[model samples]
Target: MTQTIAIDNSQKLQLAPLDIPNRLLLGPGPSNAHPAVLEAMNTPPVGHLDPAFLGLMDEIQSLLRYTWQTQNQLTIAVSGTGTAAMEATIANSVEPGDVVLIGVAGYFGNRLVDMAGRYGADVRTITKPWGQVFSLSELRTALETHRPAILALVHAETSTGARQPIDGVGDLCREFGCLLLLDTVTSLGGVPIFLDTWGVDLAYSCSQKGLGCPPGASPFTMSQRAVEKLQQRKTKVANWYLDMNLLGKYWGSDRIYHHTAPINLYYALREALRLLAQEGIENSWQRHQKNVEYLWAGLEDIGLKLHVQQEFRLPTLTTVCIPDGVDGKAIAKILLNDYNIEVGGGLGELAGKVWRVGLMGFNSRTESVDRLLEVLPQVLSK
Candidate 1:
């Protein structure tokens, strides 16, 4: 006979069920999930390996392919946040001692540098100011100097609201016999990206941003060129969970068991993707552009200066310059507490210098822009 141990109850406080406040998320990355996505997430979950769930998995892959405008058969969702998918791309492609060149213009770019270095790659970086983007000629010069095995870049720098132009980068990578890895975490559903056309070899994105879904499963895909590199790597991927060879078996026809999938998150992601497809990706891009322009006009009208140059500005997020003698964090807090509006303060080099405002996914609307513009002037006056 076994005696059960009594659990201590003194430290446990009785609390009400979670009641979250409602706020319009006008910040970087997550910009509020759609109501439909929330409802889909609430649906009862099914077994991860159930036939129905597997079918949903297939649908998700297809939708991701469409969303990314890539036909890579290995496209799949990683069972974690955007960072997990970001790590997956690095782990699968980089081998110890391989020269990896990364573009570092903002916070996330630095994140790639850290992740790549941890994976044992000899990392080289081409840097720019926080709100500036690289030129094609500069990338060509860097490729000539490093001649690296992989070239990684951030298509949209969330921290600085700068969009890196990648139209001719793929050809440059091919010319250098290197693979092109792109971070589309902030640009995926809202920005205009033709992955296959641009010849991007590997890319990753988050569910919560342009996808209009909550933070959980993330989109990841690799081109045949990148897959070949992975297949020929001398050593096994250092991270087992992110090892694509094994993950491929689970996502591919092998259907092998890997980790337990986030069923409800997948449900939400599917609904969000479906809605995006219905809206037509091109239309969504246009919508984001129009709304962001409206937001830019409104912000300028309120005498706020934007951080990024007009040519490099992103449609999804904008970095607003924080005027001298004004507190960016305090304004953000007041907007959250009083106005029920959420905007983000800057990160890294831009810290205390700018405020990050996002018009992404379901929040990219004239109404959202108007609301933020209405409160910003009042807050600044005080």
Candidate 2:
């Protein structure tokens, strides 16, 4: 005879069904997933190893290659957000005592420095003032000085709305016999990128920012050079879960299990990539640029000044200077509370000095720009 377990009545719970405010996301990230992507996410989840799920995984890989314009065999989506992908890049590539050089001009740049150091890299950095980019000559000089095993740079500096030029940096890495890593979190789907042409050995990005998907899965890729470094590492990868050595088999032909994949988030990411491919990556880039430029014009019309040099501004995100005597937090708060619109405040060196406005992914539209402009002036007068 089996005894029935009593239902515990000690725990209090609210019986109300879930509800959340629907605000227009115009901030740094998660700028509104496309409706179709959300619909895909709502589909019932399948077993991680099911044949149908496996087929979808293959499609995601192929679509990622097309989106990044690289034929990297190891491209796969990590089960967490963009930070997981960033950690994966460092874990797979940095061996103990390897000298890793990073370019630091903003928050994400510093994040890479911290991550590389945590993985036992003897990290070195070449930094510029926030809102500036490194010149090829400066990078070459740093490469000569550090002589690191890996050189990492941020393609899109999200904190300061600056675009670091990648054209010749990869060539410098090749000449110095070092692997090139890049943080493309804010630029992947909405900005122009050619990983093969750029010679980036390792790169990672998120699904939320530029792919028009809800945050969860992240895109990561490694080239042959990085793979070779992994193969030659004398020490085991510091991060077991993110180690590409095991993940490769799971994502590759072997189909071995590593961890239980987040089935629904992958569904959303797959759909996001599908829509991006359908739109053509170049066209999507153009859309982000067009909308952001319109936003800039509107902001300037209202007596706002942008923080970054116009030439270095990112098309996906912009840093608008907060006018003198205006409380940046109050403005952002009023916009959210009254207008039901959201804008981001600064981070790191940019804090309290500027407003972080994003025109990324599905939210990069003329309507989005118009709506924000219409509501912003009303809030500012308060």
Candidate 3:
């Protein structure tokens, strides 16, 4: 059932087949997807509400719970990128004029401030320099001063390449009678995240970073307390598209239609989560750490300095300071054009001063690390 269009004789159309280069993705996100994941995406599309699709939906939720290490009944994948889930978290829980305190150590933390403000939250912030994270005592002091209704933090700050410690932040939020929300966009499958144990009331992550899938669907979860907050909201959620109250019904037993779910992306995510489960989550974390150690040592041997301290550095992403008299953008360009390797440049305050390298999910391997170290020297010399 293809339709033919009439075109004028003077009109010239340029159309061709699409082709992309084979690249080693060592960037901040959208890492190299697994072979199985790609194949899964090619499966024939099914109606979003079909019985077979509904069964797959159930399985996806189950695997997401396992991947996130939580028993939250509200765990499901949103139909957009990581930022969509972030908005859902804020929109649902933050009514008009609610005080929200956000920790700003990097770009994504700054993003929380903007998103919450759009939802009519009275946003307050405590900030440190780009490569540093706040201490539990500092957080406690902020809570005592502002006493916000919500306290949000980024678990792994992708822009600065720092992993914020969450061992006691959740307990402190509880003591202060505040709900905890976390952004795990770069840490979900690459690191250890215990939503229930860490008392994370709400959390969200992307598919492309640690899940080894294309960037489309996002993982989201809410604790019972967060659900209760939603239940008691005085005002309607500002954003209609990202309202979790409606999303919950669509993902829950009601099976009500909110929107057309991204069926193929969900298929890919299911396979990727299956791969993680097969490898064992703990094993995956250790693998990322080991690979990052190799990369760090290699970078140092080649006279490059890491931007963040070793203890707080994120294993999934690393920020390397640009050497004196070297062009950071040139390095990334040459790597892509000449070596067919892709890496990320700095962001926000660290722009032009550092390069962001990622070793996430399927891309975190000894061979990938060794390959980058092997060619980086040659590229730098020329």
Candidate 4:
């Protein structure tokens, strides 16, 4: 049954039908979702705890394990964006007055320092210039000097398009008895991230970028050691909604009610992970690398300079130095308005000096790269 109310002309709302333009996403995140993923999102909703949904949850966890390349039992998708997962990891692991050391090189690294401090940790930061990554020795010295409980770093810094190398940093954490927390928001599926082999105790990422799903559900994992730290925490987690212990109960076998999970978003994530599995994680990594190389070559051919060096460049996102006398914002607007292509501008210290371009997940294709290359020069010239 339905009821309708008649309203005066003055009272009537001026709402119109919704219409969204089709734009190619070549920005830092929220990359174009796969067709199958979008279809899955449109599927009929189910109760979060329904039997069928629970089965789907199990499948998601299994697939997440495969994607993260870890056997950590606490691996699950947090109920919010990547930042929520970041908060969860920090709030659960850091107690009041605990010392935390962060390797800061870009915007997200600074974000980690802020989050850790808000959790009542004494934050110590060792920073390099935005486009440069910390060396292994620098990390070792920081850990030895700060003697913090956790050493956090960003695996792929989106702001500056720099990739931090973590080959031996984990061993240094072990020597100093510090837990290793990493932000993989841009690198998870697009790059090689072996959580266990790399000794990452805690890690978090988003679905929108590398997972090729809409933003909402975030991938999160914690090693057994991290779980032990949470179990032994003296104080209640600062944030209730992001409490890992409570979230673990809901995401784990207990299946207790925490909140109404974003049912459709989970559906989309499941399909996205399935697509990744079908393509093979290694193959996905190779695809991103190959596509980015092509993009770099094209940009170079057009006389554009990349901000990051070749050795430590991020494959998923690249920072193009804005040529002198060219307005970065204008170029981005022209591309969006005239070409229906979306790209990102710089953040923090790099603003107006560079443009952040991303080729992630579904957008990491030769065709998309070629289209951007074709329009980029025209946009810059204008």
Candidate 5:
């Protein structure tokens, strides 16, 4: 038996009103959410399997196809962040003791090796120093020598804001009888992730970065050949929840229950993708490119140097070297507390040496860039 609280006593319970200041998000991820996305999240909840909700799911998949520039039938949103999608891709791709070749450029590539290793893959990496990219010859040599089951790479290295060129990698992987898995978490909507055109076998992205949505959902797509590899796995996938085969059944024609889908989050991402569709992927990509250039110009004018090489720098995110005699974290702290502008610190080997600045999706605009440029110097002085 439970006792009910008296109305008089309940009235005396002090509750501080929630206070959240408006902030300009220009960090590595979790960029400012579009108003449409927030409104969609406020919509009344519906059952995941409801006829209306199922239609929404179908639309989400279609919109993801547009965003990813692919016609793949297996595209769907995983109920987690970017790493979850990465883990799911690796977990589903190779079974125990399978050999895999990973290109290690920055932090995310190393993560792919770990994810594959967890599934008992014998991981070998063709390594490049931080803030650098591997030459095609080096990658090809490794691929030919290892002849592994999969070639894993991070399309955008968030740690150093370096973008890897994959123009010939997919063809090379195919020639070497290997599958290509790519991490596009920070690159997807902000740049071109031409999955079908590039012949990529597997790709994954997160909602927080380029999608301008909250971080709960991760969108992933796998080619038919990649699906075949999963089907032929001798052992069941180690991760039950992220097992793509069973997930396909639920997300496929059957619509069977594997787990309770986060209905509200799906609503949020669906509306986010709807906005992206309206904007058109190519236009959105161009907008990101333009804004990032503007940001680079301002940073250069202010005497800040870019860490990544000009040819490999990521358009959505820029890693800037901290000026001599200035404290990176201190400047970021001042900007956040005093100006309500949030930026990011570096990660892994780049930490304390650079600042990762993001111009992604809804936050990629002239006003946002201008405001940051205007205030950054002032914050740095103090």
Candidate 6:
């Protein structure tokens, strides 16, 4: 048999420049990055262990504390996305056979239950109807029944655009010997977050939503009580990378090695925090609130309806019901393809029924509000 050797001639692929549209992102998350934030992302990368990089990390943590309004010592940015920090917090806090009470008010609330279950927790959920807030009576009853090791709730439920009340629930969790875990990814920089005053033991958030930074970093804080509980845990955290013990060393003064931090994302996050500080947290909240009003005013004029009630709607994100005879997904497609604007379709149980419109951070300006409002009538007419 004569064997013929064939030469491989596959060409190395050439990189192509991506041509992106000038989109006004009015979607659920990744609203819009300020120009300053984009510039920050262009900064040169530095080694994770370099003194300058470590210094930047320290500043990032301090700014996150200011943004979160928490003085918790165990505060830092997880190197991945929002869900990473949320999973880390739960996996570190709950051990096998532990009971966790999750408040399922909307889509993100159900995510809490799933995360807790992944850590071998017996997840007991207290659910409210979509677009509704949990009543104090219902919460109190669930607390008495479950007596869980942790009480988890979403401060701003992104899917339903509902804001859950935190004051009473935080106090109840503390009184019932349950650590309070809050998901504030959509509420952190755009709203008032008094983590220390509210008795939140641990909270996690993302930069893409309210912070107006690109996706990649998850900002999280852990109260002293949560820290002590982790220290006393009988078993090691299931996930090694998210292990609070090792992560603490990297984020704390000890400065031990954990993983290679995403330098450019940190750069963008730092600038985002700087912008938030310049705006002032209270003022940022008011900005979102004002734009939400403007959105509702325009929406009502167009004969559209909001999904969540006025009293409980999230200022940063709004869920609007798709009008009859119009397809929600089709409207979104028109906005993206024709208008160069992006808004989210519904999620979970509310899928295809509602549209999620986010007035977050840099995207909360009057111009953005006007752009979406003006284009809506045209989109709906088709």
What C-alpha lDDT values do all the predictions have?
Answer: 0.95, 0.94, 0.93, 0.92, 0.89, 0.90
Q: How does model 4 fare in lDDT?
A: 0.92
Q: What overall lDDT, based on C-alpha atoms, would model 5 receive against the true structure?
A: 0.89
Per-residue CA lDDT of model 3 for 1-382, tens digit only, reads 6769865777676868878899999999889999899999999999999988888888889999999999999999989999998888988889989999999999999999999998889999999999899999999999999999999999999999999999998999999999999999999999989888999999999999889998999999999999999888777778888888898888889999999999999999999999999999999999999999999999999999999999999999999999888999999999999898899999899999999999998999999899999999898888
Candidate ranking under lDDT, highest first, comes to 1, 2, 3, 4, 6, 5
- Pairs in clash, predicted candidate 4: none
Tens-digit lDDT track of model 4 for 240-264: 8888888888888899988888999
Residue lDDT tens for model 5, 55-168? 888998899988988888999999888888888898899889889999998888888888888899999988888889877788889987898999888889988899999888
Provide the lowest-lDDT 10-residue window in model 6.
Answer: 6-15
- TM for every model, in the order presented, reads 0.99, 0.97, 0.97, 0.96, 0.96, 0.96
For model 2 the TM-score comes to 0.97
The list of candidate 5 runs beyond 4 A from truth reads 2-15
Which lDDT value does model 3 have at 46? 98
The clash number for model 2 is 0
lDDT tens readout by residue for model 2, 1-382 = 6769977888878589977789899999878999999999999999999999999999999999999999999999999999999999999999989999999999999999988888889999999989999999999999999999999999999899999989988889999999999999999999999999999999999999999999989999999999999998889898888999999999999999999999999999999999999999999999999999999999999999999998889999999999999999999998888888889999988899999999999999999999999988888886
Q: What is the C-alpha RMSD of each candidate to the true structure, in Å?
A: 0.9, 1.5, 2.3, 2.5, 2.8, 2.7
Q: Point to the candidate with the largest lDDT.
A: 1
Candidate 6 per-residue lDDT over residues 132-170, each given as its tens digit: 988878889999999999988889999999998888777
Better of 5 and 6 by TM-score: 6
* Overall local distance difference test of candidate 6: 0.90
